[model samples]
Target: MARLLSELISFLEALPEPRIVMDADYRIVAANAAYMREFGAAGGLVGRRCYEVSHHFSVPCDQAGESCPLKQSLESGTPQRVLHLHHTPRGEEHVAVDTTPIRNEAGEITYFVETMSVVRHSSSRPAAQGLVGRAPAFIRMLEKVMRVAHSGAAVLLLGETGTGKELVAHAIHEASSREKGPFVPVDCAGMTETLFESELFGYEKGAFTGAAHRKLGLVEAAAGGTLFLDEIGELPLSQQVKLLRLLETGTYRRVGGLDCLSADFRLVCATHQDLRAMVAEGRFRRDLYFRINSFPIHTPALHERKEDIPLLASSLLERVDRRPGRRLSPAALNWLQGRRFDGNIRELRNLIERASLLADGDTVDLVHVQEMAEDLPLDLSASAGDAAGEFRVSGVQPLAELELAYLRWARRQQPDDTGELARALGVSPRTLYRKLRAAGA
Candidate 1:
């Protein structure tokens, strides 16, 4: 048994990615050199609980409201994969965790081997670029992005207007095998069929009245890279068949040229409209839709992941507000979070930029945000009421039902700590626990 364990440890050390071996009880029995170099800041990892080292939790990840890959692997007796936020030397980072159970000769599960892959394309904290957010919904979307990034499958980003679908598409490009290549974004909105053909398939000299010289099309320009088609739903029916033909045959020709040129580029499409309904209405081609929708991923709207407002607001402030040491006050953040952002991240950035411009001091106060946000839409159902602590409710609903809903929302806002949530709500931990249990949270 000792020799086998030694050989296993040696094998793990040979792997490049960070890996660890654990017993059935979730204790880290051994860690490879990669794991130690990456996650060994909290002293030695052997004999310590994996949850404690990764998440600082007393219990397993699932018990603390996280999807534990080890637990899932144990139950299914197979490999399990999950995206997690782990405490790293650089701070909390998004890590893709994969676990596989090891069975003995008698078919008894003896140990589990887990590998960690840090996601460099996204951040759990404020970042200068790329994706940011630690909300559950955001994590789910990011997980899908990671899963499909390495493949050559066409990706369809579905989301509402101003939800940052283009950014998400860029992230997919950056994380894919074609990261070294260019990311060409084509705005399909308001593009005419003639323009689409010439712009996408190039145009040789004298192809039309305005064509004086050979012009490279987006398809050729995006060779060995990703071609992101933004608002593909808005692409006119006449242009849909043109794109479908290009995708189906993987070949194209210049407007005035007869030679067919082979196209070599990955396709990533985004849309705010419902393509399925459009297909049924005959407004969109079923064949084109099927081709582009090979792997569909939804980019969550700001409202869908309200818990990420604070992180996103901070990140956006850093991006839009160039003034040194400029920041949003706590009250301003709370006020920003309570409002309904119908326009999603774009609206939020607009509000932040406007408030930053209005504020004289380094801190953008609640007054500044309120003054700048006067023209925005309001949610009558739940309002911030001039303060973060004040919750003004509208519409007729049972008090009990309202309480349950508010509690659920609040829990989402502070998922890690019941104690902190209770303190914020001006209630005892025990009382909050009882309420959560009764509410089936």
Candidate 2:
């Protein structure tokens, strides 16, 4: 039944911007060249279910309470147009679709002809458009990030992990004068002191037992660019001293070499840890901390601006499922706002991804969200019990310390479940084991 319109599909080529013909069951009978190119559906189009191809949905559009222009035109025997947000290869876009019905001699609708065109709105949300929020806190943070990006000052991004510190770091690098240069990022959380030095400062051939060839360190690799050191708070004091010398002297020598080499990279370091507490406890060097803390910026946690939940969830959902019309129903947005995401955006992303798997429909509703919430890690209920005391509360703990403590507890809980532990921690199992080894677990 779908391929019945295959003969007329080729005629839509001139309409442009992804035109398609669909049958009564929402199956794509034929698609134009624009549709194929834009949607990456060049080879196969005939007989494929339209909802699956366009929305990643298991059902029809009207079922989601969305105005299905196709259905409307079919029933009324007239033109139908509806504006909807579409996920394109470029990004999330507002598209105006014009749907026309093809009818038989008896005036019964036989097929739907859809023409899509991208729309530009005057009252569009700018800061919230791609970044996905108009909340004051998020807006202020974006302003600070933009300001910090233009300067050459060392940036100390203070945010809980998964609050998007690295994203801001990349934004800063992109906005800087050194954007054309390399933007190298290194995870400092899981390296030994020796490994840290070698990785950051490179190594001469025969520098160590396994040193078969000369290699450039991350610093050298990032010369004339930005070197982003992630999880800076976890860097050991021994390695911190070396990093301090490089920052102070602007030079570092290769492992097993005397000649000092210069690296002209801008420094951008991030940590969720409170460095002042570490400095007071003599765990972090005051001099190094002062040097790197030149321009401090904080990324707000998800719970900080709950008002932006709708924007963020919609943006994240579109990102997870890029099919043009996939989305979360209003109930799903409310569901997200009502919950406690101690893990912040990272947790929300995981939940959304999981819910997408569980949801058989185009829209993820309250039921789908609640069903997926059962598996979320770090139960607040458990946190209220003795496990709360187990997680601890001192005057103030470094972020790294808190994370390590949680990892230990989670490890105990899932000793044989590496995947579960990784999912719980928002990291891969390889990263989980690497962190354990680095922390001497």
Candidate 3:
């Protein structure tokens, strides 16, 4: 009988859920491996009160006064079950608990055997593998992107800067039948007006000054693949005309060459700018706008989809942990959710990376995040205040006026290029020129 009891105890201990044996006084006699893993220290639990092991409290179990399963099992000398929200040193966990009284030879309750199984929170939809959120707007956008991925038509992604426009473009390309093809990205804003033509259409040897060797442009290089044109609104008007021509006939010639080459690649363009508005204002070519906007997808800004912030923060923390042991604390996550991420995902990533570097321990806390926020050269709060002040003073100025104010503020804060602001505000150089024209700046 003793051997059988020992084997039974071992079997219960090996169960996935936590198990424990306690005396009538709630003193823990034995705890299983799962309990040890969760409580962090099982050895010290023996002969300690159940409250000490589970709740880290010195008093008796709070539920014991309300017909608790453990108390009931001991009093009635019968098995009992209950669902509990258990608080431990780590965190709160939902559990299904069962307690059975062990009887002595004379039929008196000797000990209570407790078994617990964690209750997992059920999710309504299958979680997105690499993405986040299940909000209607987010789901609708994702569905649209999936639907458009099978078509061969050119896709134009529209969104604010840091809204993950490039990510959506890449998703469309990867989900399409052209998944096997290379995804080539070209930053249209990075090139100068003079360098744009040679870079996009390739240049022949000695095509222009310092053109030493024949080189293939991004268009030709992405043949049989997908060419992602990022910040396409930044393209010069002259380059827009050439790009439109290629879209119309898929034919282009190297700079200074008569031979025309045809590119058999998929085209995906992304821009934070409003091409339709630009076209209406005579800044962007109407024909070019129609050509590239065949199928359009808009990525939501971080603020617009605040519901996904928690998941995004958790994923970012996991990514941060990949480098080292750095992780986000609950306080840090709460702080992040409350923050105004003007730069959106890009800002969040930068903040996380900075916090990881500055964190003294594995867990990133609120102080670390606050320090990182303070370190940001651009005072986002002050910028927001200035914008509000301008709005109040001007009684709703034109977007151009607001943009100029924002640009001036951003330029004053950071010595780097104003390209980020230009993109985020969704204004082309020509449109910005018109803003300057109107403002007389």
TM-score of each: 0.86, 0.57, 0.56
Return the lDDT, model 2, position 348.
Answer: 85
Clashes of each: 0, 0, 0
C-alpha lDDT of residue 285 in model 1: 99
Q: What lDDT would each prediction earn against the true structure?
A: 0.88, 0.75, 0.69
Answer with 2 or 3, whichever has the higher lDDT.
2
Worst 10 residues of 2 by lDDT: 120-129
Give the local distance difference test score of model 1: 0.88
Rank list by TM-score: 1, 2, 3
Pairs that collide in candidate 1 are none
lDDT of 3: 0.69
Tens-digit per-residue lDDT, 1-441, candidate 3: 355446657877878877887878998777888877765463577878876666556666555432367777866778987655466544555445789887766777777888875433211122222444444455555656766777899889888898777777777777778888888999988677568778888889988888899988888888878899999988878778878889999899989778989888888899988888888888789898888888888888776666666667666666654455456788877657655577887788778777877777768888888788743222123434233333222234345445555554544443354455456557675665565444333
For candidate 1, write residues 51-132 as lDDT tens digits.
Answer: 9999989999999999999989999999999999999888999999999998876788888999998999899998767799
| Clash pairs for candidate 3 | none
For candidate 2, the C-alpha RMSD (Å) to the true structure equals: 18.4
lDDT tens readout by residue for model 2, 147-179: 577688999999776787777788788778898
- In model 2, the Cα lDDT at residue 65 comes to 49
Minimal lDDT window, size 10, model 3: 120-129
